[model samples]
Each structure stands twice: as C-alpha cells, then as structure tokens.
Target: MPSATLRQPPSIPKWGRPKQTTKKLDWAEIKVIDLSTYDEPNGKQKLAEELRDAVHHTGFFSVTGTGLTQEEIERQYDIGQAYFDLPLEEKGDPKYRCDFAKGNYFGYRAANEKKIMGTAVLDNVESLNIPKFIPSNSHEPFPHFLHPFRPEIESFSRRSLDIASKIFTLFSLILELPETYFSDQHRYDDASEDHLRYMMYHPRPAADDAKVQNTWSRAHTDFGSLTLLWSQDVAGLQLKTPAGEWKYVPPVPNGIICNVGDTLSFWSAGYFKSTIHRVIRPPEDQAHIHRLGLFYFVRPGNEVDIKPVASPLLRRLGLVGEDAEEREPVRGLEYVRERVKDYHDHGDYADKKGKKFKVRNLEIEDEAS
Candidate 1:
C-alpha cells in the first residue's frame, strides 16, 4: 500500500483560491481538509468554514488523513479487482444482476447490462454496488472464497460512514445549527439505499478530443447527500465549470475527493453547488488501461424529511423566498430508486410512480448550478 502521506500542507491547499470567485475553478486549488486537524481546539470549526466555501463555490474538494488507512483502501481495491475477474457467467447469475426493470440496482451491474441515457451506446462501465450493511444479520452471500473480503468491505463502509458523520457535524456547524442536526437524519440502522460502489471504466483506443463529446458518462449531478471517492490516479473524471467548459479533476494522492450532491444542495436551499460532472475518454497516455473508481454514496435515512433547511445563511443570501417555487420532498429510499431508474432498466418490482413522491424534474436545461 502506498502512503497516505504523499504530500502535505498543514492547514490549507497548495494552490490559491480567490475569494469572491465562483467560476473557472482550478482543481489544483481545491481544498484538502485533513481530518486529523479535528484533534486540535477549534480545528473542526475552521475546517467546516473552509468546507462550506468549497461546497458552495466549487462543489468538490478532497480529504486527506481520513480515519481509514491506506492499507484498507488498497485491500478493498484488491478485493474488487478479484470480484471483477470472475467469469462473466458466475458474475451474471440471476442472484447478482441488477434487475433494474424492478428498480433495484444493489448488486452487480454487468458491463453489457447498461445503456447510457440519451445515447445509443452501451456503457463501458461495470460495477458492484453494495447497499447499507446491517451487522446483526447479513444477506446476499457471495462465493465461499469471497466471504472473507465481505467483512473487510463492511468495515470500510463503517469507516466511511464515520467520516460522513464527521462531515455532517461540520456541515451543522457551518450552518450554525446543532452538531447532530444532519446526523439524526442519517442513522445507520435507518434504511436508505446508500451504496458503496466499486466501478471499473474499461479503457479504449484514444478518441479524437474534437469528436468525442460524450465519450463515457454523460454530464450529471449525483442524487445523494455526499459522495466520498477514494483516490485513484485515473484522470478521466471531469467537472463542468460555471464558465460552461469541462476540466479534468486532477488526482490527489491518498485524497478522498468529496463532492456536494443534489440532496445536500436542495437542503441548503440551493445555496450549495451541486456541480455537474462527467467521465470522458482518458488522456492519450493511459487510454489503453482500465480505470477503477471507488466511491461511497452517503444518503440520508429513508424517512428523513429532505427539504430546504431554514438556514439563516441561506436566507441572508436570498436563496429561498416566501413565494419561491418548491420541489416535491424526497424520502431517502424512494429517491434512490427513482434516480437509478433514470439510468437503468429497473423492472416492475420497483416503484413506477407512487404516493411516496414524484421524482423532481432535474433537467440539465433547468439546472441552476
């Protein structure tokens, strides 16, 4: 395992972020909040302030020195690579395939099982997505040899959840609310379709940069609260700038890239930036090799009421108005199902449309951020 200590700047990023700026972000300037700082007095508060600024303006940042060790991340990656190495038949057994027609995407997503939205091409991505794990009773038993890795994966999930909880606390402070405000709505025992995904983006011959508009994933915003991405050297991930251009998100060593999501932005009364991002063809240098992405999507608990927070900060900024248009409230579990349905062919077993709530119309043309 490589060291998490690749590079260090004690309190801030190596590059400069201009104040009173919101567009044409320099990914190199993105803040990296070292979680270990929380041990110092007022460290959490300081980190929260920096985090709030990053989420509101850039919508993405990184965290170094997270509680999870580098070895754990490497081990999980090794486990995922092993899982992906299985024969197609074994991985595609009915038990593991995502029956999207039923709106369920909790298991294996075969490389050929997906079609990109608004594109005729079948996606070059395959992934294993595991949902919130309950320690008391486990299900969906894997092959005998893989059982040993399950505990490791579960432990990783728990550690990631711990990091999410800490960030939620920082968010609470940033919003001038009680530290437990967001935590209460995200209890682990509560059923939310939050996922820990191990995704692989298969490589291809380099495409002409001028001709490839949507080479891999189409531009989109994530539908959860926060996405915790374990660092990878893969350089295909790009984020849309306020200036309407795509820029690659340069990889940071041992840095878990964090991004604000739709739920968090909505909760903040659209104050937080739910930046649009996409995956494109890799650079010419590495287009011949597969790229692996590891992510943990942190979703709120199922029954948590997701609506605009009555934050004084948002009010001061005039983000929410007395007569402002409103979107339907989202309950966590149902929201996950609805979001996945848009990108997959979930079967009838999933909610089609229901009393739970309609999926909010989040069209790109209508997007604010």
Candidate 2:
C-alpha cells in the first residue's frame, strides 16, 4: 500500500541485442507436503520434522490443503489482471508506482526496470508490492480509480499471512523453541517489512529471451524469514542444487510454493538452507505466456535480533559460526535495509565490502569476502 509517483515504465518491446550463451539445465521435481494434517497432535511435530529436512537440504517445498480455495486465489489473479490491463500510464501513476531506487517497494515497478542480475540487460518483469492492510494499517492508498480492488487485496494479503503464521509455528518447533517464538515476532502491528507482491514476466522475443534466460532475474536469495508464492503455470522458476544443477519448480494444483530466506538461514545459524534460485525462459508450450506471479514475503519485527539461535540441533551439526564477532546480531529491519540498498545501488551483494554476511558453509571465511 506504499504509494508514490513512479517513473521508468517497463516497456518490453524496447530491449537490446540478445547475449550469447550455451548452457541449459535439466530440471527435476521438488518436495511437496500436505498441510491438512497440521491439526493432529503428532501432526504438527511430524510436519516440522519433514520441513526441517527440506530446509536443511534444498530450502524449497510445495504445500497443499491451505484451505485457501482456488476460487479465491483466482479471484485475486483476475483482479490483478484487471489492474494490469489498465493503460500503462494509469498502472504506472507516479503517485502509486513504487520507488525502489529510494528503498521503498510499496507500489508498482514497470516491467524491464528491475535488474535482478547485474548483466547490462534489465529484467523483463513488472511487479506491484503491497504491504499488510488492516483497518488501522499504516500505509498509503491506491489511486482513486484503483480503489475498488483494495478490499480484495487486503483480504487476500491477510489470508496469506495466516498461512505464514502457521508456518512460523512449525519453524519455532523445528528450532526447539516455544511455538510462539517466531509468530510473536511477526505480528502485524510492528513487523519489519511484510509484503504481497504481484508480478508479471512479459514474454520476450526468442532472441532476447534466450539472451536473458527467458527472464532476467539472476540467482539470488530472498530478504526475509519466509516467502510464500502462489503457484503459476509458467516454467522458468528454477532452483539450484548443492551439486550446482538447476531444476524447474513447476506449480502443483492447489499448492503454494514456500522457500526459506536469508533471515531464517541466519537465525538458524546456517542449519537451514537459503538456497540460491533464478528464472529462465519458459518451455516451448509456454513460450507465448506472460506469467503472473503472486507472493507473500514475511519478515520479523524491526527490533528482533537476527542472530544465531542457541539450539541443540545446530550445535550437534557443527553449523554454528566459530567467529562470534562476525556473528554479532543485527536488527531485522536494519539487516533488510542494508541488503536491499546494496543490491539496488550496485546490482550485486554487499558482501564484497563492509556489509559482510555469514550464512551456510560458503567459500568465504568467517565473514563474507
């Protein structure tokens, strides 16, 4: 709901020569877990155990039985399509477009402006970032013409957060802490930055698509504790394995894709995987499709300290950092702000310099190099 006058429209027909590349990945299936069992006494623990393994390994999973009916899901999508169908000028109303350059993403970002990868080419994607909305929510309103859709958006975002809240319970249990540990930190009132993002990857010319990999988003990590993505039919979303192979993460019927983020990985002291991921060109069947992506990103409260937790499991696995100084805690909001600022400014991670980070067993030493 963060509104602003926007600039730099995402015009797909305007692009440069395709880059040359000769690499392709053979995608495989990912894990799928049913959440309907969550109500049983042992069900919650079992779910946590199953999730622990998934996060410990690939950090990606598909969840079904969310009780968020397909009708509601499609309703939001249809409404989103309505907004996207507006004249480019209306959608890009500078008063409502998100100014990402200013570190605020509460509005629209025209297609082809976000450079997810540092390549000279811009990404062929447009996104609308909406913050949480309660009657008393602290946010700006959409342009008057778009006001009719606000109720649907607000309701959808709340439902999305409901699921995230349950997932937080599982995470707290997995970390051997009170079930409320994570949920308490993510309450709507004072949470750091949680958003519902609507995205579209404009279909590119074959040459440009190949040059930019059917899409332009490079392999990168999410900025928060968890990200809930409503499944889309396009075939470009891919995950990188520890073996360095890329695999397609296709949508499952009635499923919502969930992925871990940098904050969760840090909190777990690298016990869980915040795997790297990217998007590529779609399959031949989907070549003409312009993909629509729906996502809910969850972060902790601003004052929460995102430090390694004192958990018996992390110690047993020897994943905790040896450099206590390097692992010094940072506020959840500060961590998010710095990481985002670095990427927006330099088109890369801030790890190369003073904003060092530590997550998992990477080639870097105690701190990012």
Candidate 3:
C-alpha cells in the first residue's frame, strides 16, 4: 500500500515562461520524407539510414505516402470533439477511474488531474481516452465507452495500429534488430499485456486573460519508446533541442508528429532524445480552438529485457556509462502504473529517494512526523 503522508501534489500551475532558445522550425524547409519504400528489401537499407538521421538529429520527423487522407483525419478529429461536448452526465456512465490493471482507457480523465509522466506537473487539459481495439479476456464484451464516437474512433484506431505496426518494423530494421522485436514481445494470445493508445482533448482558456498562461501545459518528456501525435492546427507545440533551444512545431495538414521517448533513448543508448514539449491553451477568444490529438505509444514487448545495445556510435557519443550495468526491463503497463502512482503520491520518489516506498533507501518515516 502507498503511504498516506505523501499523496501526489495537485497539478503544477503554469507560471512565468521558462527560459527557452530562439531556434524555430522553418516548416517550409523542414524535410518530409517518404517511408513507404521500407517494404522493399533494398528500400529498407535506405529507410534505415534516413531513420537514423532523423532520430539522431531532429528527434522528430514526418513521413508521407501511407495514404492517410485528410478527410479521415478530420472525421476522427470531429468525433473526438463530439465526444467531449456530450453533457458531462451523458459521458460519465463509463467513468474510467482507477482500473489501471487493464489499462487506463474507456472514460473521461480530467486534465492536470494526472501527474505528468509521474513526476512533472499535470497539464491543464481534460481527456477522453480510448485505446486501440484490443478485446479483453472476459467472456462478456465490454460495453462501448465513448458511445457517440465509437464507430469513428475505432475506425481511426484500427488504421493507426496498422500504420504503427509498419513503422515499428521500420524502426527495428533501422536499429539493425529483428523486425519482430516489439511485436513478438507483446503477444496477446499468450496473455501478455499489449499495446495501448489514447486520444486527448485540450480545452482553450475561458478568457483572453494572460493569467491563464502559466496554468496550461508544462514542459516535459514522453515516457514510452515512440509517440505518434496528430495535433491541432493552432500553435503551441514546441520542442527543446540538444543545445537547449525550444522550437515550435506548428501543425502540418495530413501529417502527424513523431517523437522519440525516454524508453527509446535508453534502449538505443541515447541515440535519440525524447524531445521535451508542452502545449499552451489558446486565449479566451479562441475558446472554440480547443485541440484534440491522437497519441499512439509504441513500446517494446512486455517480457523483453531492454538494455543499450553496444555500439561504436554510443561509445563516441559518451552515452554508455563506464560502470553501468543492465537493469531489468519493466513491463510497459507496470512501468506506466508505477510512474503514475508515484506521480500521484510524490514528485520525486524514484529519482530523489531511489525507490517508491523507501526514503533514501531507508524505511518510510511514520506518518505522524
């Protein structure tokens, strides 16, 4: 059981803007590449090189030619807004509170309500999360959670999963590893935990007041191996560079943004950095400019042990520590829950103290103190 004394802190307030760099992306000059050739044996090698360059330098990139239509994208976005606009009473029946064992999908999770990445402050955006269509093991089918948008959302999810699978395979090839690395690891038929996906709706501020600025999203890194995000056209997406610069990523029609995550960085021995980013709510007059995004988190298989693969590039980059030893790979779901719980309980239990229940490697102090 978690100790009662250190419950997670309330959502972190958006405050004075943090110091940021000036380098901004020239969307016109930002290269968009074709990844479809990855299917061909010869094309895989070229794709691998491209993947390496994108991962190593930009930490984010875009690919075209998967045949994703603008209409499909808009439809999905519309469905998300429709779901969120439902009367609060109408949308509360499938309340997705506290069922972490099966995954955190199926209901409305208020924004800034969950600790960001288990340690950072929560972003001030409520969300109606619906993961990929993975049927649970129960004999009875679970009732559809987001009723009005079920068909559309599910259609979008199926398409996203197919795209994710192809991209994961491309990622494996780029890393010079077996294509089945992640897929084989998440075997649903074997009872292992599988992949999870979600949709997030971030509301605009109520007034055009600048006071609401700091209360919006806070800067932070993503958790999984890879994250594919289909964001809003309005501004507010920014990425921190290796040189400590923050650049905005304005939306590109018919394209989704892909970024490496902490786990992927660790797995690839820091070949990639999980770019840090945050969203600022549009001003009050822009209330109707609410943002809805689809996030797909691709992770390594549940049972696979992840350690930095030894490489000369890693050595040259000084990413591998001299005395670093391999650590057990935490299952994706387990990793997520542990971090979320810790975020809800304490801001820095793992990093500051080394363990969740232990304090500086010592037993937790009595609550009375």
Candidate 4:
C-alpha cells in the first residue's frame, strides 16, 4: 500500500497597518533606545545610561533596530486579526474562555461582556492570551483556529522574548548587577504567566462612550515585570505623567514601546516607576476604525522570589534595607495569579478610584482618574 500524505493548514490573510490619525493631539516626549549597537563592547552600558531616566521617571520608552522586519511583525498581526474575525460562537468557545475567577488568563476574552464604570455601556475590549510554547503549558486551552499557524506563532513568541531579554540586560546593568540577573529570572522555558497577546478595542457610539467617560480601558498599571507593545497607528493610548497629565503615546514606525510593570517595580523596591496608562475612544478622525494591538507581557519565572533585589544603588538610596532579604517571600506566580483575580473576577468595571490591590507586601492603586 502507498504511504498516506500529510495535510497542510490554510494560510491567513494579510493585514495592513491603519493610517495614523490627523488630529494634533498632545504627545508625550518618550525617548527611543536603538538596539542596533547592543552588541558593541560598551553598548549595553551606554544603553543602560540612556534608559535610566525613562525608567525612573516616565516608566515608558520605545526601542528600534530590534532586527525584526516589518513583514514578520505584520504576519503575526494578520494571524491575530484572522482569529478575531471568527464567529463569536466559534472563537469564544466556552472551553477556551479565560477563567478569571480562578485567576487563569490563558485563553480568549470576549468584548462587551461586562458593564463599564457602573454604567450600562459594556466594555469595548476583547483579547486572546497565548501562553509560552512549552510542554508544561500543553494542557492549557488554545484556539483551534490558530493551530495551523503554530510554528510561526511559536517563532514570533520566542523572538519577542529575545528582544525583551536584551532590555532586561540593560536593567541589570543599570542596577549595577550581573548582566544576566534579570534575564535569568525570566527564562523562556520556565512555567510562568508570560503571554503573547492579541487584543482589539471596538468602537462604541459617542453617546454611550460619554456615559463611561469615553474609557475603552480603565487606567491602571500592568501586572507583570515588563510589557512590549508593537506600534500601530490608530491613536487613543495615553500614559499618565508624574505631573498628572495624560499625554498620547505616539506610534513609532517599526518600533516597539516598552514599559515597567508592577513586578519590576516591586523587585526594585519602588526604584523603577510603573506608570498608569489607559485607552480611550480614538479621535473623531479615527473613531470608526477598530484598534488592533499586539503585545508581549513578561513575567518572572514561576518559582523565582520577587523580593527586592540587593542592588547597591537601591541600598544607597535607602529603597531597600539590610533586612530586605529577610522579608517574607512572594513568588512570581503567586502575585500574578492574585492580581488577575483581583482585576477581573468582578462582574462590572466599577469605579475603583480609592481601592488598593495587595499581594503580600506589594500593593498598587487599583484605579486612576
């Protein structure tokens, strides 16, 4: 008998980048770090010094020369757009939905599932979080629509981490520690909450948007160590400045925006700033367009202790005391799971202005105006 032939998966349609908004909005002065020189003798140190002010003050910046081509980045976006285009019943299968009550955020999240700001207007954002491609995560639910592109998705996920690893090295150098200190704690093979996310914000009527303060997403800090967001054109992302001003985060062509998160801030004993950010309805020029986003959220290894690092700078600044090492330990997974639950288990996106979300000794303001 003749051997059977193997079947190949269908290809995903191409996705084009959207045109930028024409509105002259207030833009933030975010510094851009070029990584092309990262392999030079003193490159890492130089980059570290350049990045110091941004991390300490704004907690946001952009990166260029990451060696990822526009074609490769757009391919991932195409895959994500195709997945979101599937029918609700097919894409939002019960088995693949996120288990927020259990603090598991590894699957699909449908849009408009809950009300916003105690109003009748439902949340306008939807997202799908794909965990790291490791054997330990094989048991997690994955969408069947994306199975065909697994190889490409896996490669993209790993490459995103490689870029993040370089940034981590810069952080370590900035703290005057071994270059690999932060990267080692975020090994890709380890079981953690790291995810490559595909998210979208649908447009709502202006009247309904007004009812919810025009917030597509509430103001809050990210829950991980670091976040990498691939730049896209539809406008609405804004970051809160130390001066309490909300300025738009402008998109850089072929560049990735980076930000510090709660865990990194915790590990540095408040030395690293975790700035608050949110998405609002796009300006009238782009309000009808859907805002698609690609992101990689980096979490420390599940077993790594999240206590304040023993950095000389932190010590000299009095951010960490001699007994810092003796403080009760909180593992990476423990804090992340608790945070997911605290942010998502509720039935509505009520006003949480004065609320505090705590995990052990680390706590962050749950909401911002």
Instruction: Give all candidates' CA lDDT scores.
Output: 0.68, 0.70, 0.52, 0.91
lDDT of 4 by residue, 1-369 (tens): 011123575876888788899899999999999999999999999999999999999999999999999999998899899989999999999988999988999999999899998888999889999999998888887887777778778889999999999999999998888999999999999999999999999999999999988899899999999999999699999999999999999999889999999889998998899999999999999999878899999998989898899898999999998888888888989989999999998879887887899987878897888
TM-score for every candidate vs. truth? 0.82, 0.83, 0.70, 0.97
Model 3 lDDT tens row, 1-369: 111123332232221211222334333223455756767767756766767777776678766666678676665555555555656565544444434345433345554444433444444565554444554423222224344445555567566656656666666666656876544544433332223333453553344224434335556566556677764455566666666665667565567778776566666676775666655554334434545565666655545555665444555667765533454444555554444344334332122223223212112211110
Best by TM-score: 4
By lDDT, highest first, what's the ranking?
A: 4, 2, 1, 3
RMSD of each: 9.0, 7.0, 10.4, 2.9
Q: Against the hidden true structure, what lDDT does model 4 obtain?
A: 0.91
Provide the clashing-pair count of each candidate structure: 8, 11, 8, 0
What is the per-residue lDDT of model 1 for residues 1-369, given as tens digits with 9 covering 90 to 100? Answer: 111232331231121111221233345456789888976899889889879878878798888878777767877777677777779888667777676765666778877444443333456778887776764224543333355555666678878888888888888888777888887777777777677888888864444323335466656678788999887675677888767766778667778988888788778877778887877776555665567778998887877777777666666788766543355566776676776666465311111222122366332221222
What digit string (tens of lDDT, one per residue) describes model 2 on residues 159-201? 8888988888888899887888888878876756788887877
Kindly indicate the candidate among 1 and 3 with the higher TM-score: 1
**Cα deviation of 25, candidate 2, in Å:** 8.7
* Pairs clashing within candidate 4: none
Instruction: Give candidate 1 misplaced runs (Cα > 4 Å).
Output: 1-28, 115-120, 135-145, 207-214, 321-328, 346-369
